[model samples]
Target: MADCVCVVSEFRAGNFRRVSFEVASEGRRVADALGLPLYGIAVGSGVSDKAEELGFYGVDKVFVADDAALEHYVAETYVPVMAEIIQGLNPAAILLPASVDGKDLSARLAARLQAGLAQDCTEVVCENGVLKAKRPIFAGKCLAWCEWSQGALPMISCRPNVMDCKAADASRKAAVEKVDAAVPEARSRALSVDLDTSGKVELTEAEIIVSGGRGMKGPENFTILEELARELGAAVGASRAAVDAGWRPHSDQVGQTGKVVNPNLYIAVGISGAIQHLAGMGSSKFIVAVNKDPEAPIFSKADFGVVEDLFNFVPVFTEEVRVLKSTC
Candidate 1:
């Protein structure tokens, strides 16, 4: 019989990702509801020392898989070791972040274990000792609640910034157990990686975001948005139109076909708010839209709206933010 709830914690650059704590907190809730223990799985090179951090978020035990071969995330190498650890625990439900790597890991693990999997979940709830996940469907037009079949293990990937991460209890500690990384020879391996050195927070994890669309006229105009974003300590994003026009890289695109974000504040400058764009960021806590056209669909969904040319308004907004930050 299945017993504990397991959360797969993700780390990068020797630090735990914020979503790791979010999922651990959610896993704690599920574990408590089911009257079971909460376990965390951490796999990476020299990561055993960091496994204890998950305890602050509520994990009762952590399984660490440390190996030089596991430094970089290769689906083939990670899936097998993770599967081995998970099978030993026989967890009732498994939680992972919906990050690029996490999503890949969860999908492969689900297939390997033949478990029921839910992806990009915005909410997870416990009902009658079972876990149900709420996720967007039909281009974010609706939400669907998903549950695993009677005998299948429930594996869920949660969207970042949507779930609340509680304050850590410094006194809490989890029992850490080391497991052999014993990875299989990969069919293919990454020879090298080009890391993002932009020094900006990732869009999916940013608390605030400033996004531009075709109305910005060209890529050069993004400097105005960048200035404001810097003052706000936010990330810069672009609509699909801007990306398609080559004004920004595809990494900055936010839409149904792009990355979904759930930031606390989303500022849309000159964006007309296509359904695809709304599908990605409509779950934001607060939305502010600035567009020259009053009839832009973005205004309908924005908590605050401004009708003005982005060229004229953005500069003034940037200056105001600068002044506010300077005074603070």
Candidate 2:
């Protein structure tokens, strides 16, 4: 059996997450550089039918483990199955998305396989047939490169939105092999899960994000930001200050203590850009800051800055965006 690059597909809520494609694309890059085949592992209920979609992103084959017990991500069951498949294939390297479930599964799988694991990597590459990864360190203050020991398998989890997702070819199709799920009895089971049904775009996966801070004044003021977010088809985020002030839910907080987001465009409204907050969104491709204070730290990081009161600027901007979108 020849060595190959394997990517674990991330499936949730009956849909494959975008990070799955990004991971696959990164896997393809490494695989090509190493002169190896790119394979994918899809573990989910009824995921077999959708496994072929990975081929569009450059996967040569897909190993599907579809079963009712695998519907929801249970680490106990998933870790064992993933480990078994990986051991059988004995791939040179394994890649997965650094998502909530992906992170959990990757960490457990690495421990089970005794492999060197790099989590939340922003960059990965193949150097001299060895897998090299770069990940953030010190609260996103710096990046560190990682490499596996000669005898250890290289395991990596790429951060969402950091990797480039190539244009998929709809005509491409991967060979699919059905594998037994062979789920074991779980030690614990979730009693219930509360999902956010607010219909807002998921912050981590969004292409554009509009975030607010203490400048919004209160919870009711988020309405203006929400309107702009809707107009821009972006997710709404809040700084730790806003969340701590009870102006926004913890789920919407974006900072070192909250969620890290890397979107194509990030609009910071009324945010002062504390280091903690910048740690979360500093990786954004482009940043636009709007603050009344000329010396707000957010302006220092923003590609564009507007020294104006958000309360006076936001409503007008929202209306302008609405009009521009209407014309389109």
Candidate 3:
């Protein structure tokens, strides 16, 4: 068995997400379980100070690979460095986020290292010296548990927003190691990263999500849902119908092909909640649905149900929430 676990950290516009912190905590937990030292790999042009935070999260060593060529994400640039580090240190496992960029890098690294990879994992743990990971498959219709057959370092890509950020000590220290890194210039590179501009909160991080569907009638009528979302400080999501109709962007679609979001509260207005759609948000903590159809599939999962037309109902709901937030 290898004696270390490495977590790959990403820097976007010089800031890290909670996903990185969560991965560090998870790596620490796995390390402790298997009697291995936890290590962190932070890649960027000059991210030395950020490496210090990894120490607070229980990392025994922080590997910093800084190169002027590493300034942007070129798969060719990062995968080689990650592969080199894993081969040199021979860590038992490595963890990265299942975010857009993360899947790309993790999959590439796994193949280059000829290692086993469990993608979009909800859980990973070492049991009796076996590294086991759990992930939903078949669009959440089934679950799979993975353990490497040959004991290759298990490369894992955990879904963002699924793991909670562990508390930090903020006083711990890590041995920092720097290696010679080269950026292999790619023939093709990112033309642009165009994120759909949104006045609504980011769906992945939002505590509340308000989603609408065909029942909302048309694109112009989405204002009702938008107003309700604004009042609740919730993100606006859409069913496949709304997205397909061009009423909302595909990024705002929450389903098997879209984003999987587990929020504190999910409010579905006029959504039918297909199994595929439910798979995405089924893990949410609480649900409230408003549909004129009492027998709608969405109602089966709702903690509260209102059988009424959302157009006639939202004004009252918005007023109540506004008053409640004001009082608090």
Candidate 4:
């Protein structure tokens, strides 16, 4: 008699992240609609003390599988843990965040349990007593709804920031269960572990992103871009050319193969619009592109296009925004 929605937790760079909150809030919604409980499961090293925080997000239960071996994200190590829990719980549904680590974990978990998984899902709805997952396909050009035939629990992964969560009473409490590894069961294992110890912003989670491209001339010009980003409460991003030139870290790239983003404001400086770049950020609400080339492809997608040199423009633009922000 398990009617619950389970969300896998993400713990990295020393703390819980936005994706966990996004998943918890999302799972809670689906669970509430079906009159089911919401369960939040976290796996990692030194992560047990944070279990209480999950309760604040409306989880009826928080499952923590903290282990030194699980310190880094390894699909092989994590999938079995999730599989054991899901099989035992037999919940109505399970929801995972549609993130890089989350995608890897969800895919393997569903495959092991002989269950189906939906990824990059933008919308989910219930129809004819079955839950429907709406996901984009063909490079996000088209969308489709999917339904599965078997498995007691339907599995889904939600795109970040796609759905706003409904506020819940954090005072509510849930069970905190400490589980064993179900060792030798996980099909995968970690080899080399490398965390991004470098203090740089990840594109998906950054609310403000300032991106640049070929128009910046060369690597040195990127410093101006970084400075502007720093002044504006934003993360520095780059187009493929900028990364290929070794001007910026690949982690800062926003594109299909890199990271897809929908930040509140995306500043594209000197990036001549390429379909690849647009594909990643066209959904951004406010796109401001600054390129001297009047016909640069970036302008077609920008809410405001500035036909001026980035070197000549970014400093002044940064100052204006700074002044405006300070006034308000």
In model 1, the runs with Cα more than 4 Å from the true position are none
TM-score of each: 0.97, 0.96, 0.92, 0.90
Where is model 3 poorest over a 10-residue stretch in terms of lDDT? 191-200
Candidate 3 lDDT score at position 84: 84
- For 131-184, candidate 4 gives per-residue lDDT tens digits of 889987776667889887855457888877665654645676557889885644
Every model's Cα RMSD, please?
Answer: 1.2, 1.4, 2.1, 2.5
Top candidate on TM-score is 1
lDDT of 3 by residue, 1-328 (tens): 5757889888765666667887888888889998888988888877776777787778889888887667678898899987887787788888998877788999999999988889989888788878889898888888899888865668889876777667888789777888776567777666655654655587877889999988888999888888888888889999999999999889889988888887889999889989989888877889999999999998988899999988889889998898999999
Rank candidates by TM-score, best first.
1, 2, 3, 4
In candidate 4, list every pair of residues with a backbone clash. 76-188, 273-298
User: Could you give candidate 1's per-residue lDDT for residues 261-281 as a string of tens digits?
Assistant: 999999999899999999989
- Candidate 2 lDDT, tens digit per residue, 220-251? 99999999998999999999999999888898
Better of 1 and 2 by TM-score: 1
Worst 10 residues of 2 by lDDT: 187-196
Ranking by lDDT: 1, 2, 3, 4
Candidate with maximal lDDT: 1
Clashes of each: 0, 0, 0, 2
TM-score of 4: 0.90
